[model samples]
Target: MSKVYSTQELIEILAQERRSCMNGQRLNLAASVSGNPVIDRFLKPEGIQKFSAYNDFKAAVHSYQRQHQVSGIIWCELTMKGKTLRYPAIDEQLAALDSDLKILKAAKADLLEFWYTGIQGMDLYLSINFGKDYQKIMPNDVKEVAQKTEWANLYEYKNYNFWEIILQLGWGKPEEASYKRGWPKSGSEYIHAVNPGKCPIC
Candidate 1:
């Protein structure tokens, strides 16, 4: 069975995972599942849709931290059980991710791609394929946010290797999608080829 997470719980999990990666741990997308719903959800293509350049994302987080009295920025949405839950509204407090791919590109990162997610929604996943010699430094806001998860308790998903993780999880139906695939359960399969909402992995 899959574990569920409250919004706050999920954010902490994501922060932990990001910190682990930042500390020089490698995550093999094809074989890793943190076994936590929110972290797993953020691992998907949908989460990656929201973005700006890393620096821009950090700036937004800093601005939000000051004006809103929050610690930093991350993708945020409502979720019930292991599925992403969203209300029909635009969260202006959140960073605008619509132009993130372009912004990340302007920063000179390579390997830019985006996937469509209903209406005008899209996510950014900058590969930063420069390898370790050119690894981008983890933004201070991100470090600050993750460090203060208990206080900030906010995070958002943005596209980055999310699409690839989706591909690794396989597609079509639960039976095939879950077999020998990275996804741990069949119930998490995306049930629709179109009109997939925030949770593509169900």
Candidate 2:
């Protein structure tokens, strides 16, 4: 007989498998269950959508819940790729991003993409892509808030890359977007922007 697992247990199992098999990318639990007869029957295309950004995904989830009277936890697989840092190091970045995201969401920044990229022997970096609405905010304020939010904390021996942040601008999604700023130069050294909110969306 097969061993039964609780919902949380199954989620944990899937997450572990994704880390191992998918090069540290988080498992998209919803997409994983998509097309299953039972799931499709309940959550048809009209009831579910996919978004590359957490803010948009969250807003959609809440809207669906309110309209359908559904009651359940909202869950999504957050992508985290790069060298493994200590648990505290990871937690710190999460906490910082959470704080900053809340502020950005309230400002209606319309985030389009948020992710980390890099791996062992590579420079780990955090990136945020925003829609055109981001331009309403003051550039300096955007820089100040994001820098304090621990924008890049992948490695301990912090340096130029540690202070670097990419601010991408466009509509729909980052990949489909046509605007981005090259790395900025601070003093005499080349560095990326301090935060994405400062980027002008086209």
TM-score each candidate: 0.17, 0.20
How accurate locally is residue 91 in candidate 2, as Cα lDDT from 0 to 100? 19
Clash list (residue pairs), candidate 2 = none
User: How high is the CA lDDT of each candidate model?
Assistant: 0.29, 0.31
Q: How many residue pairs collide in each prediction?
A: 14, 0
> Which regions of candidate 2 are displaced past 4 Å?
1-14, 20-162, 173-191, 194-202
Per residue, candidate 1 scores C-alpha lDDT tens digits across 1-202 of 5444433443454455455544435333344445798888768432232222222333545354344443222333433224453222112232223243233223211110111122123221212222112122222322332232111111233354332111111112222222334243211211111122332321
lDDT of 2 by residue, 1-202 (tens): 6554433443344445434434423323354336679767776342232222232434444354344433322222223344332211111101112333333334323221232232112222223342323223334443454443312221222254343333332122111122332222101111133332233212
Q: Who wins the lDDT comparison?
A: 2
Could you tell me which 10 consecutive residues in candidate 1 have the lowest summed lDDT?
107-116
Say which candidate scores most in TM-score: 2
